[model samples]
Target: MATMPSIRRASSRTTRGSAVALALTATALSVTVFLGGRTRGPAVSLSIKSPATSTISNGARCQSRGFRARAPGVSVNLWSGFGPSLGRRGLSMTVAPKAQVVELVSRVVPAVVPEDDVAIKAFSSTPSEWKGDMIIIPVYATPKPEGAEEGPNAELTGPAKELDGVLGGIISEMIGDASFKGSKGEKVSTFVPGGSAKRVALVGAGEKDKENSDTVEALGASIAGVALDAKVASVLVVSTGSQPDSQALSSGVLGKLYADDRFRTGDNVSKPVKLKSMEIEGATSDALDAAVKHARGVTSGVRLAKDLVGAPPNYLTPSSMAGVAEKISKDLGLSLTILEQEECEKLGMGSYLGVAQGAIEPPKFIHLTYKPKGEVKSKIALIGKGLTFDSGGYNLKAGAGSMIELMKFDMGGSAAVLGAAQAIGKLKPDNVQVDFIVAACENMLSDRAMRPGDILTASNGKTIEVLNTDAEGRLTLADALIYAEKLNPDKIVDLATLTGACIISLGNEYAGMWSDNDDLAAELLESSKDGGEKLWRMPLVESYKEELKSKIADLKNVGGRAGGSITAALFLKEFVTKTPWAHIDMAGPVWDAKAGGSTGYGVRTLVEFVAKQQ
Candidate 1:
């Protein structure tokens, strides 16, 4: 039901057989072409003729000269010289329609409206034109009017709202009602549309008065999401209008497509799929080239995280996770160190080891460092709770809580940290020092599992009263945070699926962030916004710290369920000596059974924060 406008180009066709022959000979140096000629055997010479100069009349015989058939039933249509610019590759020929050179060129050229400044618009596609394989869209670029206010258009009023309503309404009608929704009060899509050939999409840079590159990137992501759902083998996105540069649009769209499929798994066969090839039309040779490369990089990073999180717990235990880190270190030139139970015992990590005691697999305290190639301005340490699987320890989860069967996502925090390290390694930012730490273990039930009411000391030698064995995330983090403090980093950030209390407070849409340092908290908030991850800063009331007080030990792991999340932060705060630290309770964002995958929530935000620090 989406509208697709017909693309138009200036008519300028020429028949130059010699030119075509020369170009073909030049191309032959780098490519091999088999052709059919007078003899039954292979032809001695092969050459292509220029496109026949004529009006694109329907069903017209468009023939080229000196084109030797590569194989039986092979046909080639030559057109005017239209090679892509340096660093930019033209759209793959596979997505082009099988027609005469004139018709094919006419159908695929850029579309422009005379004197119109709009960057995005909706067009109707006729049923006869609906090939249904893939939809090709043209995006144009328009500069925003000077003095325009910055922010999302959803925050506009009066004239802006009226204008947006018209534009949004047109887009809604083109793509169909089901393709759009309001996310956080902004118009967006729910599930990426899967049916039609490239079901409804928007091209960037329409009206000069309303142009925004950020919105253009978002539109590309939206298109990619739909492409994924449609499972089209590939997509063709064409750039149009006066915008000589449409490559940014392509990059944005490809980036989103990669992000959409990043966390997916092969086990689930029910969901809609994406196309294998994406082609961009009307892009400057340079823009098209850069967009494709950027898209591939983004997709690669996303897949890395997905693979780490999707691996089964049996294959990705604390030790196995450390092994993976060791491999990455050797491959990416990172420094890796893993502390086993013996080392942890020497450091008095009783609280962390208590959780691992129940499992046959011993815990691995992992530390990974990435130092840039210049003077280090600041050092940041990231801590992830690497609970390979959580059986709730002595406090077991049953019935609905155990339905997912795979608790491997309990190590989502660790996966995120590893993913961040991978991305940062490739990016290679300058003048920044990064340390990745993970307290990897399994919270399972066995005869030796620490029981309720037992007291254990952390790496800092601080005793903790274990009221509930299920509250084990904090037990491991307590020792991990203490260990990180010894490094004296500028900032310490820890991520964990720590408490269900966070889920109760923030729901699944946002992760609950607790930090005593305002500047660090603000920086993370900004990073979250840029990364498109939802995070809300929660209060760490001093009064809440009193709830953790224990008559027998320094503090109780569980704070009687009231302000459970805040008290958990308080318990962690006790060990962080003079360091600016933040705790991301990823309990809500780690896994979503109904959504059916790990969200990879904190990875992007954490990476963006690190990049900005440079």
Candidate 2:
């Protein structure tokens, strides 16, 4: 384990409107302090002494060691990234008249794993055999013999036996007392007295046969959360009782360590977590290496999607998003075509344009293509709804029915597809062609916004009656689906945060999936299982189509409240009659309120499905 360099910090307490004296030495200089807590004055005074020498050593203590202000219980932390220098002849103090003291922090490089690389390794070894800062061992519930006593049973097998022997039968003792039944989510941890390892954790997987990729992934995530609190830099995970999915396990381990603190500032005291590496025991094979590589690729895409979704609307407009796509295409050597508003008008995308008419920002119709170096096996199209900000248009969102502030994440579908493009472009699997499409725009309120009864024509010349302007994502997707179908792909899949009904049905844990083809649906389901994303199949009930009937146009933009999600899927199905089609309603699982980050839900599933098809 590599040790991080330590920085010394110190704090002081003073009475209201008083000066705190700071003594200077040959190498040390006075540091700037901000009084936020435990101070009662609107002004603060500081006294500094000039340093005798101009140059200082690398580890010179210019600032006080991390300490609390004794006077008013305030904390003091100085910027440690700055080199030792006063650069002045006289000591001076810049005072500000404010209610609280302000602390100036120097810019320092954060200690975290690079977004593109995750350190993970797999081995076929026991936990006790591998040395690390800590070892995470998973144990599943196994039934004991009917006549067996309250002691070691025949079911004690695999790594469990080896770990029990290594711990001097502590694991068996716990099992004998019925203290560790191996129920899912149950955990027990202990410190090693004298061994290569410092600590050991036993996590439970409910049943041996019931374990899958999701179970392993969840277990690995739990381990990461606990280990981060423990501040363990390196970890070794030992899987017992059954084979765990190596990719899912590793992805979970790294995923939980992901923290987006790009905007963090001020005199915060919590230390940042920096996990160096993770090694998995009992996961040894050539396929396992490939799985780990694939896992890294998918994780990169998911991270990109989450970043895009979390970005503020002002920073991620349609034009700005196109600029990002342009850079990604250039970097990955993929073909990129960006259509401006006029170009889309020439293409007669009325339904898409109608939604854009309300916003001041110009719409961007982005198309990206990826081709393999070898012979092509199949062509696939992925379309995403890119309403960067959805304000529900003319039938404006308000009160409880409104979440206008968080509408910046309306482009979640596009973020997922773009993320997949980033991964696939780098992975470059042979014998497959993919087309990525997004009708990126905003749905804001304006005089030009489409009215509730307005009729708009799609690129396919299908007229839609706008029953609810809030249902604008489907309109944009309508034209994108038509454009994708023209590419003559073997299959087409479109994803959107289109309806609340889907969220009501599936909640935030799983995304709702609907498909016209059973084989395609089955293939995607299997791929999602491998990717560790939960997806539930939904029905495209034939009766739901009748609810979308428009007296004036070919169809209504939205159906009534009852079975609204099914009707929404039915409406999208009209645009792609020639191709095998599937619709993924990603309204739920995109934003994680509990986890406090964009879930990046569909990127891994898409990448896995496409990779297998290739």
Candidate 3:
């Protein structure tokens, strides 16, 4: 006996001639529509005026001055103003699903609260003029040190030399007193006696020649962690290199400075540190400023992703995940399309919905599209596994090491997709369009859950055998890949926390990547290298498909334990017909024990790839 939920919409009825038009002004976009809750409930029906033919751009209505039905979701607002007067047409239209309203509508949705805006000042001022609550100098260790009888002290050079002189040689004095040999990951912090800075620290940047974006990013992260631990509001990073990376430095600081306190209750709520501002002495160019803006956008996406992935399974169900997508579309001016269970069934998404059969939460297929006003030179599709929670279905994930409780992050792929969408939308990269899709659902245990030995058909008519219900992400992605391919995208890339074997193979620092095209893999690798996110390209051996052969159906979900990640990629490759597609097995790097929360791993790489695409 479930309680019937209430549905209330505030669109005023406007009558012209003999027809009724639903006024979908920005204020009238207040809709709290839900088809159903966790349990069964009657669907909320919506009837609007005739769909408008007007165009929608930048979240605003066009010539017709109303919403239009281009695709699904609220991309064109509520009522599309067609023929100057939708009310005069006397046409009635019925929209399914109540809550999934307003795609790319001109509405004021609450913005994602990013980490406190740490003002980054790229000043023309020299190191001598640098004054802050703390100063961090990244130093590289001596040339050779493995078997030396005594390692020589690190020399003060470049910005370190200039800043040390201004601090009355305190940095050199301390290095000598403590015998501080600058080894990688080494750190020494001390209070400044009468210097402009309250305290100073030297962070090891490894060998000078070996210094790369990863080490520099690490340096930035270390500075942020130290600044917060010391309660310093402003810090200056003295660069030793000729030109500092605005993106890498800011990303490291912002990413490391973040912490998730979502589940914290009263009294347990943790107040974040007072890190208000960071100054980089050598990043004083206009290009640097632009990079800083772009870096902030990337990290902002990362934070959004981290927050979504960090949510508990109970709090972020499939329907709720759609809600989050709708909010993102509304806030970021991205066109959105959400297909309900019925729509999915019509498209023969049995493989995707089969995984959702056991859950009370209905699967919500989400598609978010970002279109540039200029001529589209290329189109890209990004897909994510939207499993909010996975209980292993009837196969049942139970044991001492099941790690089932942590399955809330099974949706990390979807989080990364939406995170990247948020970034692409806000940054507004021109000449390229990106479509973000997620087949959001859960794999919970119930009497209705899909069982082993069940054969499910995908929309592409390809059949899948349920050999292992535990392997459900590929089932959802099977349908999503087909959907993405239909868009005729030039490139399609998907990210998923797919396998434990990936973690075993690559450890927790790098994500395994598989691609059909070598050029796409190289591009991703290059972008990842620039972003300091580790991506290891794995093999897509055609021979691996032999492992997926099923006796009754087209293929089996899981292929034994040998090369599990490779087999998983091979399975997803079946759904692709024609597209330069790449699959990322991110189970290893999705969670960083050191980052304090979800690492938001795929965001920076994906954003950089799409934003820079010609």
Q: Which candidate leads in TM-score?
A: 3
**lDDT, candidate 2, 202-321, per-residue tens:** 777667678777887787778777677778877787766566777787677767766766556665534566567677777776767787777777777787788778877766777667
What lDDT is reached at residue 174 by model 3?
A: 77
Worst 10 contiguous positions by lDDT, candidate 1: 89-98
Candidate 3 per-residue lDDT, tens place, 395-444, comes to: 88899978898898899899989999988887899999999999999998
Candidate number achieving the greatest lDDT relative to the actual structure:
3
Error of 1 at 135 (Å): 6.1
lDDT of 1: 0.61
Error of 1 at 350 (Å): 1.1
Q: Count the backbone clashes (under 3 Å) in each candidate.
A: 22, 5, 7
Ranking of models by TM-score: 3, 2, 1
What's model 3's overall lDDT? 0.76
Q: How does candidate 3 fare on TM-score?
A: 0.80
TM-score, per-candidate, Cα-based: 0.63, 0.75, 0.80
Q: What is the C-alpha lDDT of each candidate?
A: 0.61, 0.73, 0.76
In candidate 2, stretches whose alpha carbon ends up further than 4 angstroms from where it belongs are 1-118, 124-129, 143-160, 163-178, 267-271, 542-546
